[model samples]
Target: MGRFLLAIGAPPDRASDMWKRFEESGAMRLAVELEGVQLWSSVDLPLSIEPGGSRMILGQVRSRSLGDDDHPSGILPQHEQWPSWPKLIEAFWGPWLGIEYKHRSLRLELVRSADIEMPCYYALAAGGIYAASDADLLVAAGACTGEIDRAALASALVYPAHRPSSTVLAGITELEPGRRLEWTPGRLRGHALWNPWDFALPPAQIHDLQIAAETVRDAVLIAVRGCSAGQRVILGMSGGLDSSIVAAALRATGAQWSGVTTVSAEPAGDERYYARCVAEHLQVQLAEVPDNIERIDLRQCHAAHLPRPNSRSFSQSADKSMLEIAAASGAKAYLHGGGGDNVFAMLDSVRPVLDRALDTSGWAASQTVCDIARMTGRSVVDVALRAGRLALRHGRDAPRIGNSAFLSQSVLETAEFPHHPWLDTPPGARPGKVLHVNWLIGIQNFLEGHAGQGDLPYRAPLMAQPVIEACLRVPTWMWCTGGRNRAVARLAFEAMLPAQIMTRSAKGTPTSFLYDILEAKRDEAREMLLEGNLASLGCLDRDKVEAALGAVQRLMSGDVLALMRLIDTESWIRARIARQRD
Candidate 1:
């Protein structure tokens, strides 16, 4: 994996020290100085650097046709025929991020597709701006104070939602996906360069499921071909429709790919049977990594400097084992079906169908209401009443889902959690469009943060730009026909997947392992939360937290999830403190 640190507008002397600090963090293996910016990276990145222009392009690019018509239709020119310098930007596709330099200014841009992840965190320091791919590097360089942002912490603990462009540290900001930040002599401006919603087409414009399926299949194949060409690929097979489809696509391309799955001793948490079925159907070699909860080491479960809220404590060893196996197998990329549910398995809400039908005609609306009634096994009158109620309350704030009762009153009072932007979108907007936008943002944030954590490229073909656009253009009714989620996708891959695998609805839950982990480490967890920085900083009410921890065995699943979040927060804060002391 490649990481970068850039210091712009700093004095020449200060820039040198900043570079040294970055190197000392043990994260950077190479350092280079441009006009007014210093770039440091751990890997010798594939960067097309223009020293004179102070511009650099990191990662590979696939050629795109500009449709000049002077050239062959729909065919990309050879790399030799590509344009040079800034002009090359227009034809650039694939997983790439860029940094452009102007007169006393630096601009950093994350790719539109959010593949080849490069997360940038920035803070003002020493009369200049410093940004790094790692937040810990910025803190080490003295660009940020390292104080936890209480509001952000509260939001994470209480809302289960991450603020779009904010980090846990005060004054340190992360650049959102598909956004650019330009830092001039003494000012910085952030701009959104792409919006997935803009690609969404009205339902009236889409009429064929087969064409949609073909478009999606072609996009996935292209993405897999581009990413896994001439490389050993490993697929994380979950035996679900998403991963099964990806496996089938990889097989269709005649690529060298294998499947790996993590299985648990607990039957409830094990999916090895389903995984085996998919592997057998696809005719791929399968490797199983047994995640025995008894072998989990509590010390190794602690967060390191950075917080990974979505990660589970029991899966760390299994994750490391998978990475090691991939490395040993000479794998260049690991393909998994991330974001498949968000893009394809839309919610089966009646509101969207009702809205679309009403916009068309009364007969259409009544028919839709009847379909919904049949699908939901509710009376037509009841379905229509519920749809009307939903329509009336559209675009209004709903209740937050996370457990905030355990938070300290002071923290709750002072924290400013902004309402989700999607909730305020125009009421007349298609319900599917609104939901798609919400899921896109959440999934993009997740993939950018967690994917590609190790050296091997973790590619999600399902999240490819073309595939997401195609899925969005599909009507909502198709997604959840007959009250089945991801109906379109199921129909699309019916022939490639087994009936059992395609129609399987029961998802494996890791609750048994989670509860076991908590039980095994309950005492340590209690002490950590009670005496850790979270309590010391007044982010949590000690009494309530103690009670909750004491009642873990009796708590519901939702409460357990909330407690896990608290534990993660406490662990992260403790790690930050230890690093600061070091």
Candidate 2:
């Protein structure tokens, strides 16, 4: 959540000069290099060292560690700067960007937490690589060319979750979640810090519901407490199991926190009843902000400054309200249950049934079929028959997120590629787990940066690395226990949440809100897209897009969502064009 710039694999002079180059812009004031390590960061206590220094440790990271109020801002305690300090962060866990460097050697390693998404980018510069947590800084420092990357933009438009490394900015690479890069002069090595496949396909999978529940509970608490330390947190609560569970953790942490829920005028978008129940149960003050679409600036494009257009038109109202609440109340962070569904294996498919049959014996498998049948409203025979068919004949059956019909076939045939490295698992891998991992891939863009929320750090604790790992280890079938999706998670917070929230089957959606936005901004969106880069760049088909927008009233909810995504992307593209013209 801190803005930083670093020079890796550069000669000493060039590496040392980066501080002067970026900082002289008055953007990065003071907080310069760590003497031996050339990292200049805005985070005061950004580095952590274990007391024993025995093995490279992740728990020792001050900001990410639990119950540590002393350096809650994390790691900067004015200790003597070590020459090897940067290198020690090689295996650094959690949602931080760590760069390992040797003082004068060509040896350098850059690592970041896969727990939550932070915008980090690196561009190969003259004789070295210049990296930064903010893409603008890299572009300003001449590390990035400042030119837009239309090819990457094409992939993002068709499928936003297309790839991890490629960013909307061309020539710049995003250090993806749970991944690391090691540079050794001639060759650069990069690999995943953690793999969901390992958790899904293994004897390591958590089969016991009790154990899985306990593990999830612990991980959630750690993720919450670590981020909540020394900070007043404003939680985005939706009376849903995920946010309610987060509320429970906030209660346990004894931190200064409050729950804020956005009330939608549309019935489908409203979840106040559940939010109120949880707040009353937790005995916390709840602030309900009504979603006001009239308040949204149709002409304003939030992704104007972002590396990509990731923000939605809906959040323009909700996030504005939350930003005001957090600012007025002196809160330093925002927490939400954004990725709970995916992390908890909330799938609509029969993969859970298939997964259950794979590991369980006759009675357990039979019970699972019944449970899945009840959850999905399918007959037991149908569930069993489907599971049998999937198990018997499959190369890799993990469902993939397909491109929308609005996209051009040329873009589909030519630009299509494997969206994520983790998506392609080894042969015989469980499609259920692959499907679960796919959920994680799809939700990556939801990890919004602090910049969008008035500089207050945004925390998605449920999506944190430890919590993700714990849930990934959980057997896919375990989520459907007692015929409930995410039953393990429900079990984890059974005591803290209200009974109604624990058992509620329905969840809110912005389908109506999407329709509302389209109706309200239909003309604006039409002019924007018809004249924007998406159609001109050959990313989306013009006639199809025109039909989706022109017939907004008659279009389905999914089509509306798709159109909104294109508008947001087109808005970003137009903003970039205007900036260049300026």
Candidate 3:
């Protein structure tokens, strides 16, 4: 719900013109200009300027003992007097972006938790360092070039779940989480301020599960209550353990909340029964938005400014319907359990357990083997042998890049697609750390870049840093007990959630509905991809695209997701090209 543009080295006149262009784009509801930075934001953002100072803070900050001192304005005085600004910034919890100015030097900081969700993109253009929350805005303001970054585009196609720090525009780089960028005189520097991995501790060090569960519950309640304070909030209830836990926590706080869920006609895609169960248990009115696959429109779903195509296109109509209901209900913010799976419920992976066993004691290894045997219904000998093989095979490896049939050979050879760093990390380092980072980056990017475009502020209480850190402290064995994924979370809320929801193992799949939408709009997609801007740019092969369309017409089911990704990429490329020309 907030957007900002900052130019560090540009002349005053050029900065003013860029500000004017952004203001005219209808993207910002308020505009502010300081010595060198110009900030534009939506009305919902809690933007505060320091009294008689060039420092400003945007978004809400939450603390346990701070009381009203948690507000950014109240905390600014302490930060100003502190010797180390980065250390002070790192100690707080909340979603926020901060800007500080002194003696003509400008510094921009993105909170380590990335809960406030501000994507910063910068490039050396027009004789200055220009940065903005929106990448397209930087290009449109003539502060960044319009030329596409081929590597970034390829990365999107290959690794859709990973959020690359670099953007699709050449020479433009996104500020990574827990990082800061500063510009002064003729020099600019960027550095990392914090790393969550540094705080991770071995799960065995924390012996008590009850204490952990209580701590996690407290964190969730604090986050939910803190973010939804004095506001009408919408809870996205899916009847799953994650959403249900959030609903139960909100109900415990006695906050003003309503439930909204998307229901599909396809039984495989429907979860209304469970949703209704949760809503009834909470005694809250639930609004259902029927996702009729026939209403899919590629253009309507296309988010032109995003770095890549996302699930927004797949759920565009359904989300719009849900948003309409939320807006009509007078909600100020929409809350959901986005990162619950990544944080609380980690997937069952034996590699990390085996890796830890090999590096540590044999007693620990035996315990893990016994746990695996119990969970997988396999013999101890079999589990131990398998674990040994996995441990021996464990090493750094490059990510598996999927081959796109449509991408031009020349582009593929020349583009330096950035590799995912986690792919090279040691397996025994810490369980769920890599997955947590992936979810944080991916979800934050989607929410800020695409979902925040809605009328109300979109919030995720389950994604709070405190909750995530608490979950990370949980051992891998506890997460997947008895062959169940997210076992810890299920056990934590056993008394709060209904038996059906708390024990439900299977999740509803939307693949069928997605394919149906693609088939429903076959003709339009064909024309768009066959002669689309992406094909003209040599990013895709026209012949292969036509073949894919033919397969879709025949109801074939080979890599349909990849085909959809191609369509999304082409749609975004066409829209971006149009914007550049404008």
For all predicted structures, in order, the TM-scores are 0.86, 0.90, 0.87
Best by lDDT: 2
Per-residue alpha-carbon lDDT of model 1 for 529-580, expressed as tens digits?
7887777888778887788777778877766766666776666676666667
Cα lDDT tens digits, model 2, 127-207, are 577777756667655676557776666666667754557677777787786677887666777887656676677576987
Error of 2 at 11 (Å): 9.2
Predictions: Cα RMSD each: 4.4, 3.7, 3.7
Candidate order by TM-score, decreasing, is 2, 3, 1
Candidate 1 local Cα displacement, residue 239, angstroms: 1.8
TM-score of 1: 0.86
Task: Point out where model 2 deviates above 4 Å.
Answer: 9-25, 30-38, 43-73, 76-93, 395-397, 449-451, 579-582
Clashes in each model (backbone N, CA, C under 3 Å)? 0, 3, 1
Summarize candidate 3's per-residue lDDT along 1-582 as a digit string, tens digits: 455665655677776676677568766654566565566676666675566655566665556432444542223443343324465445556666666756333444333234544456677765566666666767765776566776677667655666666777677777665667776556667666754454444533334667767767777877777767777788888777888999988888778899988876678778899989988887999998877765566765346765545536666766676678777888877888877877774544454455345446677667667766766668889877866765576532323444555666765665565543333444445434444444444555455424335466667778776676667666555566555667767767778778889878777766676678777888887877777766766767667777777776454444576676677777677677777787
Winner by TM-score between candidate 3 and candidate 2: 2
